[model samples]
Target: MAFDERALVRGPQPAVPEIVPYDDGWPDRFEQHRRRIAVALGSRAHEVEHIGSTSVPGLGAKDVVDVLVVLDDPDDEAAYLTDLERAGYELRVREPGHRALRETSGRRVNVHCYAAGDDEITKYRLLREHLRAHEDARRTYEDAKRALAGREWPDMNHYAEAKGPTIHRLLREAGWTGAL
Candidate 1:
């Protein structure tokens, strides 16, 4: 099934993403959430990793921490969903192989759930690693992101969608041959 946005989401339109300069505190923020998530879900969290622009040092981003929570079976809600909710993440997207949640306190945090061995998960890692290791890729991505930030978007998803092409290009440049 397609993903559904059910909670902690804003109105349907004009969601402007403000890309901010890289903050030294971003990692700490992610670690704080990661620890809480660990206490909430325990080993089922498999891996609680920092993803997205905020994960990369020196890259400007929307200031939301993107977290990747790898689960053995993301579609099995009974396994980890309620626990995550209890920990403060509100479900935001539910789809075939993944789920998305956000911090309930309006803090800038997004949690993505994906099953083990999911190709998309690998993409996230690859993109993050590429940006970290390559200065040129990071600058190009940051430039694209800044260019797209603050424009009117029907949903914050649109802002993310606008950055897709650049991401794919960078991914290719990184020698990833997987389907886009």
Candidate 2:
């Protein structure tokens, strides 16, 4: 019989590690995760995109690739959940705000799956794009994240929440008039 290494690992899994800032390997890391998700979801995914600090060069980040797998039919999310589960991602949480934010966790990956046409993707893209083009915004965002990482909230959500001020401030400066 073949040995299943993952099954042999015991105990409740550890929490995702603290943010590690920018690393040169971030893009390749995202590519590997993207391929895995793409193979698993096949046609169900309209697109899997990199949309976070890791996607922007020279920006320090949490060392995790934030990917958005956009599905065409919002009502059919339940169907894809099973496939995602099979792909080694454990469902983390579903955003109460729009129901479009579904977080998943893997050994080294944190994925936020959203429905196509959802504003979540748009906001992420806009923020990421704006930050990439604007040096001041990138530096400010990086400094804010590092400061929050030092505090080290109980989990990722709190960390994200703590960074909201910087995010909002940048968005405002970028002329993002809130989620369109």
Highest lDDT: which candidate?
1
lDDT of 2 by residue, 57-151 (tens): 88987766777787765445576767777877765555432222322453455677667767777788889999889999999998888776755
Predicted candidate 1 versus true structure: per-residue lDDT over 72-176, tens digit per residue: 898899999999999988877676888888898985999999998999999999999999999999999999999998878867766787788999999999889
| Model 1: pairs clashing at backbone N, Cα or C within 3 Å | none
Candidate 2, superposed: residue stretches over 4 Å from native? 1-17, 73-77, 96-106
For candidate 1, give the lDDT of residue 111. 94
* TM-score for candidate 1: 0.92
Identify the candidate with maximal TM-score.
1
Q: Model 1: C-alpha RMSD to truth? A: 2.6
TM-score of each candidate structure, all chains considered together: 0.92, 0.80
Residue 87 lDDT in candidate 2: 72
CA lDDT of every candidate: 0.88, 0.70
